[model samples]
Structure formats: structure tokens, C-alpha cells
Target: MASPQPLNGATPKPKPITPSEISAEFSHHDPTIARINNGSFGCCPSTIIAAQQNHQLYFLEQPDNFYFNILKPSILKTRQIIKTLINADHVEEISIVDNATTAAAIVLQHTTWSFFSTLFQPGDAAIMLHYAYGAVKKSVQAYITRAGGHVIEVHLPFPLKSNSEIIVEFRKALQMGKANGRKIRLAVIDHITSMPSVIIPVKELVQMCRDEGVGRIFIDAAHAIGNVNIDVKDIGADFYTSNLHKWFFCPPSAAFLYCKMSDELSDLHHPVVSHEYGNGLAMESAWIGTRDYSPQLVVPEAMEFVSRFEGGIEGIMRRNHKKVVEMADMLAEAWGTELGTPPDMCSSMAMVGMPACLGIKSDADALKLRTHLRVCFGVEVPIYYRAPVEGEIDPITGYARISHQVYNTVEDYYRFREAVNKLVKDGVNCTLLPLCEGYAQLLQMLLKSSLPVLCISYCSAVDV
Candidate 1:
């Protein structure tokens, strides 16, 4: 979404958001709905949004100075801050991209095709888990296919019982690839999955890749930053990318890519070549043509704002993790369904199973359910449909992924629970349920109406 131009020709300094003022902090959101989908696009505080507006106004005020002189310095400063935040070795290795997908694409597209051919030949394989994001997967497949390489998809079952299971499955895939005379070239793994919302032990996975002769590893940490503690140097991944908008409280279109400073990567180029064509990774990425630099500029302010919370960013992460667990447990128990991953394996987001009978056959059907939850029931959460894996028996499932941020309350989850339960019982038609009945009643009666309106109407309606 394009940022709206500032109103009244000036940006106001709004108060910083605090934990207690969670819901009130974000006035841009639809108040009637409980926003449990922060994992998709993060909720930006009004203060940060105002700061972005100010930066925009400043850019237009002196376009020449801002673009030629001030912009580079400001961007460099933000890179240094991000370097310290993610524990990168140097700012020069970091490039500000629009999002993680773009970052991954730059790495794949900029590298000399000859080098990729040497690393991954026609029969050789590049590995990615089945749970990898669609965009990341497509980029890898396209690049690898063009280079005459095949993909080895490591299948990971949802509702997994243990983290060790992931390690075992990965090792098996590596052995299978070796047996087929397929040398594993590059492996793409997520720090936290987008759909199931499970936190993979990336540090361990990186070591396993090294031991198994996987040439390079790309850590897709899109949902990892504010949710999981990060130490990029310690993780020792060849490449890492994460979205500031998702968790670090920055506006959309702001994310950073970190490449291990190496002589080999000195020739890397930005995807969009411009006047700064051959100026190395950092410079090339900085001048990817004229666009909104506000998202990248106000990153420091977002970091400072998050640090001002109760125990700072650490406290916020802890609170969010706890809230997600609480919500996941409540909904799982209500639906008599299992969790997508174990409790300890999840961070700020968790996926709880839904009845497969929801009849969510396509993406459109899944989206309709999500919309019904939002528009009719005033509940905003992500709904996913996981098709049955080849080896599983009737294991097909639907899932509700809930995200918890500082600007969220348990009351929001309760509202979500009430709404979802009602939807399920009405056979996903959503036409039979009172739609706004429970939503309105919750406002009038709050927790007091939980038994009659929420429990009986939604929870108890499901079979034990």
C-alpha cells in the first residue's frame, strides 16, 4: 500500500506505544476486529508512521540534497544500527531491500550464472523444506532450473511432535540426495515458518548443512527478528534476510539483507540496476531508483520505540510468545485439535489445527473464511488449509495462525475464539451465525458473556 501523504502539511509527534496501551496505540486498524494477523503485515504504531511522514516531507523539501547527500548518510546510519541489532560483522555487508523475498532474489540473480553452474549442475540438487514460503521457493526453483539444477524438497510434517524430527528428516533427505548422485549445492531454510509458524533450530540446521556438504545456506528469517533472538555472526549462515516491518515495528517495504563479508561476494549487484550499477552490493542497493526511502530511514526510531517498552524488545518478545501459547492452547483445546508444532518450538506465532470439514478446497475458500471472520465476526486472523501429505491418512487439516504483539491482548484472542467457534459450528457458511451478535455482546458484557455467548455458542458446539 502506498503511504498516504501527510495531512495538514506537517507530521504530528504521537505518543510512543506501550504494552498497557496496546489496542489504543494503533488507531489505523479496524477497531471492531481483533487483529491476530500481525505475522503477515506488522502493526505500525502511529508514532513511527508519523516519523515516516516527516521523512517523506523532508525528502520532498530538498529532493536534491536529500537524494544526493543526506540519503546515503542516513541509510548508512540505519545500516550500522541494523548491523548492531542483528549482530552482523559489518554494515558494508548489509543491503536495505524492500522485503526478504527481494533480498533472496538479489542473491540468486546477481551471482554469476557460471559460478552457479559450477556449484549446481544439471543432476545436482538444491534443497528447501516443503514449508518454505511460496515466493522464496519459486525464486530458487527458477534460478536452479535455469542453471540446469533440480530441487530436492525435504518434506516436514505439520503438528510435529519434536524438533529432533526435523533434524532426522533433513539428514535422511541429504542421504537420499547423495545416493541418487545428487550433490546438494544450496539449502534454503526458514528461521520461522510462515504458515505453521514453527521456529526451526536454524543454528543447528546450519551446522548440519555444513557437515552434510551442502555448499551454502540461506537463512530466511522473515518472521524471526523481533520474535526470536538473533545473532547472525553466531548463526554463521552465508546469507540472511529479515523484514523490519514484520516484527521490528518499522513500516512496510523495509527489510535488510546480510551477506557474510567475503571476497567472493564483492561482485554482487542489486536486482534493479541503475546509475549506481557496479558500485558493490551496499551502494547498488541504496540507489535502486527513486522511491519511498521513509521505510528504511525510520528503522532506528522503530528500534528505539520498541526498546522503550517495559523490558524493552526482550520483554515484548516474551509477552508475545506467552500470549500466542495461551491463545493456541485455548483454541486447540476448544477444537480438540493438536498444535502445528510443540510449545517450546514456537515463538510469537503459533498454528492451531482446525476441522478439515471446513470445506476450504481452494485459496479462495480459505480467504473467504478469513474474510467472514473479519467482516462479520470482527475477528482478524489468518486461516490456512493444509492438504494431506502423500503418506498420511486423512491428515488433511485447516489451521488458524495467530500472532501476538505488544499491541495485542488476551481479550483479542478470546474474541477470536468466540468468532471462529461460531463460524465452524455454522458449517463455515457464516450466514447462519448472528455475525455481529457475539462481537456486540462482548463489548457490552465483556468476559461475563463468555459462558453463554462464547462457550455455548462456539466451543461447546464442537464435538468433544
Candidate 2:
């Protein structure tokens, strides 16, 4: 298979999306030409995109003065905007990074693990959920194992009955760790798990960590920032990080790492080779050498753009959340499956577990869902299988995670339901193989249409 062409060069002519054509309840302003499977990366409003372009132009005009005098101050201002958006008391504690993964890695690398070593020793404990992002889980495993630390895996059941059930089960796991007489060095909690799209009770869990006398709390809020209201101080965790790109409509590589103020927790480092190794804030972590600082600088504009819409940020949250729940209910009814999480635990996204009769054994089945929906129906969502290491795997059970952003409409969900009904009624073995082959052609078409304009112009295939 050939690689898809890039969309960067010879920028497409600007197309204006008017306010009246947009949904009154949501804030997104873009033409729905392609189905969006990648809301995890986020889509910026035209206003924010314009602001980013302006900044890029400015930097191109003069690079040096912008780096020293302008860039740092601009970023600090961006932090102030974040502070107001998230209701933080002070912006000093917040440091911007590329994304949540980078933020989590920095917190793990910089913190004093010796304190944890004294408590956990060589074989003692750390705890995490099964649905934690694969990257974060690997980072923690690498850090702990190198330091002779043990990690306890906590299995979170799908189709949980309630938030209390999740909390109680997690608490019981922590108690089990305590019973083993292994000091709990850290608890990595997800503000929202990616696959299931369930919001964990971070405030309750962090307090539990404190009561358990754990060393620290690290939160992965990759999907949390724009989907729900977040106040890091209220969360009461030692460390937290979230990607603004996922939910906040900020450009890619925009995220924040927040650390609680403490004289003892002063040592932190940037991930790459940099001059500010010793200096705490400006020199060490902040510089990180030269790259595009436009994304970080334009964060405030993204915040402002969201604010201008009818529902504002909170309004967008409520609107998208309601839409996804409705969509989930409809899809569940169509597929004869149950919702994965309760309404409260569900946010702007939800997961529907595939019924026992639908055989989704391998990656082929997963790609079938991705391809069939995109080509046949123009709908895009993710489907995959997950099981606890100790739990029984149902050969036929899998899940399709549906994400509803502002651009998504009720018609999109209806189309998805119809497609699934057709596929499930037909035998999986007979239906899936042809679907996958057809999907290859669909991908080719999308790639051709998505080819960068520069390539099209140079080739002059038909019309330039």
C-alpha cells in the first residue's frame, strides 16, 4: 500500500464558514466535507487558525526578537488565559508542553523518585487502570522497573453500573496493596479513559491516594480539557497534565503540565537536550531550544473563539454530551447491545459493547468497521477489542467507541446505526472480507482527494 500524501504544501484557498450555517448550540465552524475520526487531535475554529497564521508570519519576518522578548511573554499570557478557563488561582505553576504524553513523561522524569524508593523498595507497589493510555502505562512501567518498583494492575469492568461502583472497586484495590505491606508510591488516574470514554472520579481517587498516604498522583487528562470542566487545584493531585489539542481546539502540540507549589518539589527538567538544565523555570524547561512556538502562543485565541459561541465552552460540553448519549442509546437499540458506561460517566463520547453474536476476533474486524463506515456510510469512529488479563474473553464481544464533536450531527449517528445493522445481519466471515477489499479503494480515493495542492498543481492531471 502506498503512503497517503501530505496536506501541507500549496495551501487550499480559504473558505468561509458563516455563523448562521453552524449549529446554534455548538461552537465548531468548519465544512463537513470529510468525516472526522481524529477529534482526538482536535479541530481549531477559523479564528484560532487565523491567529496562528499571523503569529507564524510574524516569526518568519523576525525570528530573534520574537524568541527572546516576545515568545516567553506571549506564552505566559496564554497561560493566563488557561488559568481563567480552568479557574486556577495562579498561572505560575502551569508549564506548557506539546501534549499530555510529553507532560506525563516530564513529570515522571523530573520528580524525586528516591522518596518513592524508600517507601516501595525493590518489589513494592504502584497501581493503574487497565484502560490507561498505552504510552503512559509503558512510561510508568519503565520508570518503576528500573528503580526496582512493582506495578499493580487494576482491572476496570466494562458496562460499569455506576461511578460509586468504580470508586469502591478502586478503593478495594488500594486496600489490597496496603494489605501486602508494600508502600504505594503513586497512583496513575485517567481523567477520562480513551477507549471507553468514561470519566473517572479523579477528586475522589486523589483523596483516596492521600488517605492511603501514597507518594504522588499523576493524572492523564488527554480527553478531559474541552469535554468537561477541569480545575487542577480542585482535583488535588500532586501532578496533572492534559492536551489542549484533544478538546480545547488549540493547535497540535499545545498542552499544559501543572505541578503543585512546593519548595521540596522544585526539581523538573525539559524532555530534550537544552541549556536550562539547572535553572528551574525560564532557563531549563521553558527554552527547550527553538521550534514553532506559535501553537502555544495562540492558545488564548482558541479560548476566546470558543467563548464567543452561544453555549460557550460549558455550553459546547453540555450539547456534545447530550448528543453522544442520544446517539449511544440509538446505536445500542439498533445493535441489541448495552451502553458501556452510565450517563454521568459518559461525556461527549460513549462506547457500545458489541453483542456476543458479532464475531470481531482480529485487527481485520476492526479495520472492517473503520473502512465500511467511511466508504459506505461516510461515518468515522473507532472499533476494537479489549479484555482484562485475568478475565474471560468473549470471542464475539468487542466495542465501537463513538465520539461526538460539535461538527457531528444526529444524521451521522443514524447512518452509523444503519450500516452496523446491515453488517451484523449478514454473516461476519462472508461479509467482512469483501468490505475490507472495497475499503482499500475508498482509502485510495480519500488519499487522492487529500493530496497536497502543490502536487496537484505540478502534475496538472486534469484541472489545476
User: In terms of lDDT, which candidate is strongest?
Assistant: 1
**TM-score to native of every candidate shown:** 0.85, 0.83
Query: How would you encode candidate 2's per-residue C-alpha lDDT over 98-131 as one tens digit per residue?
Result: 8888877776664336635463476667788878
Model 1 quality (TM-score)? 0.85
Candidate 1 per-residue lDDT over residues 351-406, each given as its tens digit: 88876656555555566567556644577888877766678655536788989887
Return the number of clashes found in candidate 2: 2
lDDT of 2 at 348: 82
Worst 10 residues of 1 by lDDT: 455-464
lDDT of each: 0.79, 0.71
Which regions of candidate 1 deviate over 4 angstroms?
A: 1-21, 110-112, 115-120, 356-364, 389-396, 427-464
- lDDT value, candidate 2, whole model: 0.71
After the best TM-score superposition of candidate 1, give how far the Cα of residue 291 lies from its true spot, in angstroms.
0.9
